[model samples]
Structure formats: structure tokens, C-alpha cells
Target: MSGSRGIVGEKWSQKILWICAIGSAISLYLVGVERQTQNRFQKMADDLDDIDYSEKSGGDGT
Candidate 1:
């Protein structure tokens, strides 16, 4: 509670900035188009969960 106008604490402000920067970098990397290590999560834009993992772990390996 630095100010009534909603100024964050100094330490918290730096932490928040760093988190935002990291988040942005990750977002950029995901759609960066380099594609060295493809994001498997984004591979399934249709479904939130990957069905293959479920089949392998839950279903018999057939």
C-alpha cells in the first residue's frame, strides 16, 4: 500500500515487471516460427487436453 492511487511496492514492482517480461518472451517464442523445439501444447489448438497421452497411460499399449 504505497499510495492510494495504487502504486505497488518497489520489490513487488520489479517482480511483476520480470514476470511480465518472461511471459512476453515465452509468448513470442511459441509463435516465433523457428520451430526447433515445437510447443506440444499449441499443437492441439482444438482440444485443451492431448488425447494421445491419455490413451498411452490409461489405455493398453496396442
Candidate 2:
């Protein structure tokens, strides 16, 4: 009986470890995608800032 319980406990612990590993992998993937999206947006904003908006239209509020 004790040996059976030890085996069961070991199986459950292995399952738990696998679950944690998969969760960590998914979290890391999401973080990587988020960082890539953020960098893309930041580059777009920088490009917009580089444009001379003042030259496109009259300087006056007209």
C-alpha cells in the first residue's frame, strides 16, 4: 500500500512539473510577441516624429 501511494505521488508530481513547464513556455512566448509588437509601434512613432509636419501645411493656424 505504501509503495503504491509513493508511485501515485510521483506520477502526480511529474504531471504538475509538466504543467508548470508548459505554462512557463507559453508565458515566455507571449512576452516575446509583446516585446516585438512594442518595438514595431515604437519604430512607427519614431518615423512619424521624423516627418516635418510643419512643412506639409502653412505655419499659420489657417
Candidate 3:
């Protein structure tokens, strides 16, 4: 476009673009991996509020 103009340096522009592309790809991969952890937590449902203190060390101070 005539309105958008930049003095392109082969070294800086190419390196920056490559880094941005890799960062976006890694972020997407991490998001996909995190979905499994979210599912595991969701399976707990209402039991999340039930803390089992009786199993603690010294059996909850007897």
C-alpha cells in the first residue's frame, strides 16, 4: 500500500517476523495442552468444596 511505507532491512524485519510466528505457535500449543488440565479439574464438580482434613498428618490432631 502507498499509505503504509517502511524502510525494510533484511536482517531486522525477517528476524522479528520469525520470532513472532514462533511465539504464536508456542502459545497455541500451550493452550491445547492446558485444556486437559481444565477438564480434570472440572470433573471434580461439587466435591471441590469437600476438604478431607481427617487424612492429614497426626490424623487431624486426633
TM-scores for every candidate against the unseen true structure: 0.40, 0.83, 0.52
Residue pairs whose backbone atoms clash in candidate 1: none
* 1-62: candidate 2 lDDT, tens digit per residue: 99999999999999999999999999999999999999999999876655645446644322
Tell me the lDDT of candidate 1.
Answer: 0.67
In candidate 3, the residue pairs with backbone N, CA or C atoms under 3 Å apart (3 or more residues apart, or in different chains) clash, namely none
For model 3, how does the per-residue alpha-carbon lDDT over 1-62 read when each residue is reduced to its tens digit? 54344444656698999999999999999998899788878777534434344454335433
- Evaluate model 3: give its TM-score: 0.52
lDDT per model vs. reference = 0.67, 0.86, 0.70
**Error at 32, model 2, angstroms:** 0.1
lDDT computed for candidate 3: 0.70
Cα deviation at 43, candidate 1, in Å, is 18
